[model samples]
Target chain A: MKKNIILASTSTVFGQPYLSYLKEELEILFADAKEIIFIPYARPGGISHDDYTAKAAAFFKEIRVAVKGLHNFDDPISALQNCQGIFTGGGNTFLLVKQLHELNILPTLRSVVDNGVPYLGTSAGSNLGGMTMQTTNDMPIVYPPSFETAGWVPFNLNPHYLDPIPGTTHMGETRETRIAEFHTQNSIPVVGLREGSWVRVTDHKIKLGGPLTARIFEQGKQPYELSPGASIEFA
Target chain B: MKKNIILASTSTVFGQPYLSYLKEELEILFADAKEIIFIPYARPGGISHDDYTAKAAAFFKEIRVAVKGLHNFDDPISALQNCQGIFTGGGNTFLLVKQLHELNILPTLRSVVDNGVPYLGTSAGSNLGGMTMQTTNDMPIVYPPSFETAGWVPFNLNPHYLDPIPGTTHMGETRETRIAEFHTQNSIPVVGLREGSWVRVTDHKIKLGGPLTARIFEQGKQPYELSPGASIEFA
Candidate 1:
């Protein structure tokens, strides 16, 4: 059996309701599953785990899918193992990775995903699917036990990746520059998933989804754009 | 004697030459020092440490102060200890902290600052003087041994701090939201130092310098602004 996954740049694009843009794709992604477990460990704006999970539940409710937060379970590891599908929402990557490491479930999460359990990840969640959390745009509000992540995919991911705004005076490094710095210390390839874009992984194939082009970063090379539907498997 | 420090939000303001905006202030700040060692581990854009140091040296040359890269010394610890003044330029905070911890010189750096050796830091460099690197806006491109920094100042400093661009449709978390999230996880106060703004530390007194007002974030309280020369010691 092949692994199935959808890694999105964000849960919601600008002016859109939560998860609304990805609804149609998500329907097919979770078509066979009646219920999906949600992991709310990232907790945006430091929202409570229950409150964050409730937000996810509300979204999944619209698609007629039952949503239960991983935190609600007696044993999160067991809950993950038995789940048919899992959706991890966006927030602080460090916090999410910290909780996953502290709970000693990174291996379990990877095993289930490898076993063909459908998975959906947005923003920080998508970042975790990569080799490490080092490319995250989120603030390092908390410290994780390790920078290592699920590595469901072979490369690192830079989610919600933005192109440099023209004529902007902000002195902060561009997303491109930040990732280049990442490559300085790491040799892994990085896929810069723009807003409204995603990567769909089916078995060994990974293809870019959504209308925009995704940027690819590799060591000692200029970053280039990949059009939607382009195969990133070779990246 | 009191510790003398200059923690600027950036090396240069937009449209200004590198370190040009701070030149006048830097001259006064380093008036008594003939030479200052530079720490360039945070290499911007993955530039080599030597190259980054050259950029700093060029700027300091105009002020007639001899500059040397910390990496030039055979022993970084001894280089730090024997230096009359030190300047750490900004790039990526994680890399900077990683090198500092790996070299086992964070303690040495802190002790020198506490002992009143002249110090100058901009952006990543400035963030290190804070309680922790929790408030840094830079991406985490590497895993440092620890997030603990010099803690020379009581509160954390958020450099290159930006106000949300009005009427923007971007859904990414604003700078304010990111820091607010930091407050949720940590109890320490965070001062959002905007570009062109800096904090001058003399003994126990910390006063906002430069021409702009800075935003301060404290747990369970509304964020407020502090104008130039405003004391942040009690924040």
Candidate 2:
């Protein structure tokens, strides 16, 4: 079965326009969908389940879509089993991954998507769909034990991308240098996404969204920038 | 020819008690020392060569010490090869490791110690003597091109350890839990050391120093705490 997956770069509720834009995109992708399964368990930033549910309810009202929070749904596998579409709201990617891993819902989540239930993720949500969660800016403030992450997408995504600070003389290396170091040790590709931007995946094809250009770092070759609307084949 | 290696946690200027303590420890370790070689290139926290040299000059006044920063020495390996003792001052461990890895000095440093050079490390300097640099709380504020680290000690050291916050309700796990998680995935043990505390190693025997207790985390076993002066065999 064919399904749509939306990966958002952030979980800030203040970004109403971005959420609206994503909702519009998902609506077009799942035109015949009658309900949207909102997974707010990824929000570990002290946001209550009621607040998340209400936010989703308000956003999807124009489509008259039924919004449901999965916090009380202890059985994530079963809850996600027959869902028409899955939308992952963002907060802390590491926290989300920790819960998913602890509950053993990661594999099941992948299976649900394989069974053709569309998946939508933002920020932390989008992070889960990547090969590894090492790229997120969230502090390892809390330890989930292992750095294991879902390997849905081929490359790691660096959300909230920014350039180097001018005239900073700290002994530590900069973010770009760190990412470059990661590329040196690992062969994984990294996608630096800016605000209001996302990666749209359908039927195994990945395309860029929004107006900013995404930076790609690979070994031996000079790092290149990909403008929005650019498409790349991931093997 | 037995040599001495002193690994200091911080690079101290003249008249600093910490620097004097380090020198005293080195003197005791190498009672017959004729010269002391200083490796100040390892100091990366905006510490200039002259600044470190001046610090060394003050210490050398009272004792028979010859300070030679690695950069000024004709052949670092040769200088270390025939030195009576090598003193490594600290600043940023990651930066130190990055430079050492780049110049391929780790293997030689290890060899020097294997040849009976009593090696000592403090703070970030002490971190380089561990198997992995994962435990260092230094911010990955800047990214180096690689995570390569000096693999001296069998376990990773978490220097400057702090307990969990009293009333904060951070969603993520605490530092202890995180270290445990690291053990689950990797077999390496993590030693959580607080300031003023250190682990003294001699011929593969590790002794806890200072007043703080060192916590050890391993897979499947409950985390254990070791008091100061507790000794463990580490290769």
Candidate 3:
């Protein structure tokens, strides 16, 4: 049997109501699983290991929860190697990538996922499953030496989709405009997920969630929208 | 006499009127200097060394312009050892920080400034001179191992400040709000500079620039605005 993997978008314990929904979904998805290894080290927002572990413990109290041993990257790798499922909580995507790259866990992560470890990601965690970490809103809290992402799920995921600012000529482009600019430079499709919306990948199929629509942009094409329950074939 | 430093906020040769102002300012500042060194290697937006050099050459045709000898961080340090002043162009701040940190030039750059070497930073270059590169709008194009910034300047500079977005429930914080958040966490004051506005720093004095008012925020106090020509004492 393939182990499960869950990647969450945000590390805020109770910020988004959808987190509970996601937790419930994972419980149903991995009902037969015996152990759940929660990895909260991805949060680099100054939260300590104990704090993150406690946060996970609070949420996963109903389940058999075991916070992943984070003495170092090797422990996370070993946990991945033997665990039934892995859950990655989100905080800052860049910070998480920096840690993953520093510890050289990105390659191992890919291997486990390819071996069919059911991976789950929320916000920043969901972002790691994509091709690039360019869409995150977190400040570049740290430099990670490289921008190469996990590339597990194809395309870029823009979490927390927002509209453009009015009447402000800010030097930097807005998130939406930035994504559009990315499409102009590259031919990759981008999925903009609003709050409470998510994408579920099972085997070879990708499904959308919540009432929000996923904005899709492809090169040389007009951007389109996808509603909840819509399944997009993984390309 | 201390060597002069020029920091710019953008590299768009055209389109932005501020570029011309930067050019004029550079001409006036470097007029008396025997030679001017162009540090185009800091343009990390995939701008080729040749192209960067050529752009600097085209801009300062009459003046003796020499591209800094250190193309990447691997070259000899002597390239910038005897320079009159250094001008850094703008691009993606994250990319610039990534390269500088990788080549280990950040500390050396800081040393040059400490030794009284004149420095000029535009856009991403300007962002580098500040205490942290958190305020930049550049997509996290690359991840370096840490978020440590080139603490050349004491405050965070928010170049190209803009107004808030309209009627959006999903409003993420504006640039000002984001900077305020940083101030809440760190005591450092954030200076919001619109295009064409820069802080001229010499020794201990910091002066504001044209038309736009700079928003200065400190912890435990309401944010205030600084009009152009207002001098701030940096301790």
Candidate 4:
């Protein structure tokens, strides 16, 4: 089976319903999938796993596909192993990564996706599809055992990437500055996936999707943009 | 010796010179001190330790206090143990925490501050004065050994705190929402210190300083505003 993945910057764009922006693309990506295993470890505002899962389920229902929360399974490892498709929703990356590591199924989840099961991720979920979660914009509300994530792609991701607001006085590190700091400590390339943008993978080929351009950061080099439909491979 | 400390939200406000806003307060805080030990580990924008220290030194020069970087001393523990005054400049909290833990000087730094060393922290430095660094608003560029900090105060500090913008398209977590998430995971109260604001601790009497009101977040409770010069007690 060939790999089919869509790692999006956000589940919902501003002034849009959740997952509506990607409706057409997802209809094709999950064409053959009978059901999607939803991992809701990252939902924010203190939303519970079941509640988060139900929210995803409600969205997928419009497409006539069933969605099941990974937590609902008696054996999550087995559920991942047998699931036809997977969809991880957006929330806190640290909390998601921590829960996945603690459940001792991070490797299983990674392996299943690597085996070519159709996968979809948004925001924090998209971060998990990268080589590591080091470039995540989420706060370290909880510390994960390791910063490692699924290495389905060669590079790391900076989801919900925003350009510096001009004439703004906010002193917090901008998304670009933060990614630059990550390069100082690690050599991994980072994809600053903007809202409505995503990285689509099919088999061995990977491409940037959506209308916007994706920002690319590498060690010792100026950041550049990868236009939509361009390959995401790094040197 | 009483705990005479100042944990500021930022070293420099938007339109002011670095450390100038706290000039009068700092002079009174370090009134009897000879020199101040400067921890430049948190300096941002890819600045070096020596350069960061020099910047801090120039600021303290007005007060006739010599600022020395902790990296310059062969024995940082000894230098910290005997320093009359201490100032940890702001930048990246994770980087500072990582360096302190790697050097195995975290305990010593905490001990010295707890023993009334007239400690001063700004931004990232202020985050370290809390019970833990989990509430920091910094990017985790590097993973530290632990989320622990100096615990100089009973609660954590969220420096450079900003309220939610009224008409923004950005979907990232607001400072208030992020602090609410922190409360879900931990019980420590978090003081959202706006830029130009600070927490002043004179022994057991802790107060919010500056003109702006500090936002306070406690577990399972609605966040509220704390007026300047108001007591910062959680209960």
Candidate 5:
């Protein structure tokens, strides 16, 4: 089994419907599957598990596929093993990782994802594919046992990445500055996946998707831009 | 033996010298002390400890008070105990908290601040005065042993806080949304300290300082604005 994943920067770009842009790609990726196990642990905007799950289910319903929240299952490990596809929605990364680690099934989740389960992730969900969540932009509302992620992807991710707005007087650090700070103490490469952009991973091939160019940050090196359709297999 | 602290939202505002706006207030706060111990653990922008300390040293030098980096001493705990005043600079909050917890001196540091030793903190440094650093906006470049902070202040602080940029299309969560998400799980109140705004704690009184108003978020309540000079003592 080889990895099959769609790591999206965000579920929706500004003025877009929920997961609307990725609908075609999703239909292709999960073509053979009848249903997906939706992990709503991230709970975007502090939404409840059931509500977040319903949102994903609504999207999949349009594609004629059934959806089930992982929380609905008594055994999450068994759920993953039995599910045709998996979709982790956007939300707070800390909360998601906390639940994952607390369940003590990160290894199981990673193993199944590694074994070629069709997976879809957005925002915080996409961040879970990295080696660690150190590059996340979300607030640490909760403390997790570790910063480690699923490591389904070779490099860490910075989803919903934004370039600094010009002529702004705000003193808050920019996306690039924050990632540079991450590199100061970390050696891993980080992919700055801008809004409307994503990474499509099919076994060994990882291609940048969408209209925007991605930014790649490696320690001690200048960050370079990656155009749409660029291959990040070497990253 | 009551808290006497200055928690600033940022170390420097745009178009101003470092710590310039607060120089007069600082001189008055540290009037009784001949020197202040500087904790450079935050290491803003990934700067080195000594380099960041020197920046603070230069600013304090103008006020005729000596400055010493906590890292310069052979024993950090003893140095802190014997210090006349203490100042912690801003940087990555996770990195700052990680070092403080690893050193196992948060309790000692908190005890002294609660005992009326003059204390100054900016950005990440100020977040340390809260119950936890979970409200911080910085990237979590490193994982700390805990989300706990000194708790010298009753509520958590969100420094360098920014409201949504008017009319822009970026979809990242606003400061208010992030804090609201934090409140979804944690019950602690979070103070959104705008850049250039700060809180001055004198004995039991906590007053909002600087030119701008601050925002306060309590769980299950609408976020309210706090005008300068307003008392957050109830917070």
Candidate 6:
């Protein structure tokens, strides 16, 4: 069987309830699953793993899908192997990647998802599904053993991809500049997923979803936009 | 000799020539030195190290101080040790830190700067003088062996610190939120250095320099601002 996944730019949008923006997408994504196990490792602080997981549960409750935090399980690998569906909420990619590496479960997470377990990821969680976390916008609060991440998707992802505001005088490097810098050292393609945008994968097919056009950055090429439903094909 | 350093928030403010914003400050910092060695590792792309160094050389020329790129040196460590003064121009912090680690010159750098070789740093360069580069705003395009830095000053730095725009729906973490997350994992202090602001150090004395007030974040405490010339005292 082929892998199934939905990697979203963000779990929430401006002035909206948590996960409310993706309500329809979640319902369809989790249609056949009996239960969804959440990995709340992205949000390490500001909220406890159980508390963060509860937030996901509340949302899943709306869709009538039973959900539990992966943190509650003694053996997370085993739990993931037996789960019907999985959701990884967003937070700091560094923290999430570190935890995944420390637990020695990156391989397990990849294998199960490859075994056809449906998966959903938002923001930092979505970054983990990409080639590397090096393009993350998060501060390096902690160091991970490596910049490598799950290669569920062929390209690295810049979640919540923002455009440079026209009138802003801020001297900080814009999202495009940072990713351009990333391209200098890496050959992998990058998708600049705007808010409300997502990458939907069915088996070997990958397509862009949402109202906006996602920006694409590849090594040695100018960034261009891909319209909704456009295929994000890779070799 | 006491450490003599000027760590500016940026090389240039918007609408200003490179390093021109800190002209007066640099004059005082490098007054006694006949020449300044420039570190151009922060800017890894878009410009060559030779070209980046030329920019710095041009700025130093305006002040009538001879400047040379560290890249031209056969031994970066020895050149830094014997240099009358040093200047590290800003670009990407991750690249700067990674190069510093790979070249095995971080310790040599810290020792020389401590031995009282007058030093000037802007943005990524300024971040190198901090406790750690974990607080840097630059994207992690490269992974260094370690996040540790020079510790020329007690606190970490967030260069090009920007205040959130009054109205925006963009959900990317604001500069404040990113630093807040940093506090969740580390106890090191962080100074949000806005454009035109800098940290001045002389011997055991540290003070906030430049026009704007800097936002300071300490562990388990609320972030607050320090006015110009205010002592940045630390134990």
In model 1, the Cα lDDT at residue A141 comes to 90
lDDT of each: 0.91, 0.64, 0.65, 0.90, 0.91, 0.89
- DockQ each: 0.83, 0.06, 0.22, 0.68, 0.86, 0.72
Better of 1 and 4 by DockQ: 1
Better of 3 and 4 by lDDT: 4
lDDT score of residue A189 within candidate 4: 95
lDDT per residue for candidate 2 within A1-235, as digits (tens), equals 4536666565433325436656667677567668868877655434676797778777777776777787767676788886777778766555677677778878878877756677777777787777777666553333443445555667887766656657633223444665665554457787877666788877767888776688776655577888888885544
How do the residues A10-122 of candidate 5 rate in per-residue lDDT, one tens digit apiece? 99888989999999999998998998899999987889999999999998999999999999999989889878899999889999999999998689889898998899999
lDDT of 4 at A90: 87
Off by over 4 Å in 5: none
User: Ten-residue segment with the worst summed lDDT in candidate 2 chain B?
Assistant: B5-14
Of candidates 5 and 3, the better by TM-score:
5
Model 6 docking category: medium
User: Where does model 3 exceed 4 Å of error?
Assistant: A1-18, A21-24, A33-35, A62-74, A103-108, A132-134, A180-189, A217-227, A233-235, B1-3, B6-89, B96-120, B131-135, B142-168, B171-197, B208-235
- TM-score (chain A) of candidate 6? 0.97
| Model 3 agreement with the true structure over B62-153: per-residue lDDT tens digits | 55444443474355355566666677777666667867788777787777776777777777788887888877766665555555676666
Models 1 onward score TM values of: 0.98, 0.55, 0.69, 0.98, 0.98, 0.98
- Model 4 regions lying over 4 Å from their true place: none
lDDT of 6 by residue, A29-145 (tens): 889987999999888345788899888998899999998888899999999889999999888899899989999879989989888999999999999889899888888988998
Where does candidate 1 clash, by residue pair? none
Interface RMSD of each: 0.9, 8.8, 5.9, 1.3, 0.9, 1.6
Candidate 1: residue A143 Cα off by (Å): 1.0
**Tens-place lDDT digits, model 1, residues A1-235:** 4889999999999899999999999998998888999999998888999999889989888889999999889998999989989999999999999999999989999999988999999999999899898889998999998989988888989998989999989898889999988888889999999889999999988899999999999988999999899999653
**Judged by DockQ, which candidate is best?**
5
lDDT of 3 at A83: 67
lDDT score, candidate 2: 0.64
Residue lDDT tens for model 1, B91-193: 9999999999998989999998899888999999999999999988888888888999998889999999989999987778899999888888899999999
Kindly provide the TM-score obtained by chain B of candidate 3 when compared with the true chain B. Answer: 0.84
lDDT of 6 by residue, B143-222 (tens): 89999999999899999998877788988788888888888889899999999999999999999999899998888888
Q: Looking at the true structure's interface, with contacts defined as alpha carbon pairs within 8 Å between chains A and B, what fraction does model 5 recover?
A: 0.86
Model 6 residue B181 CA deviation in Å: 0.9
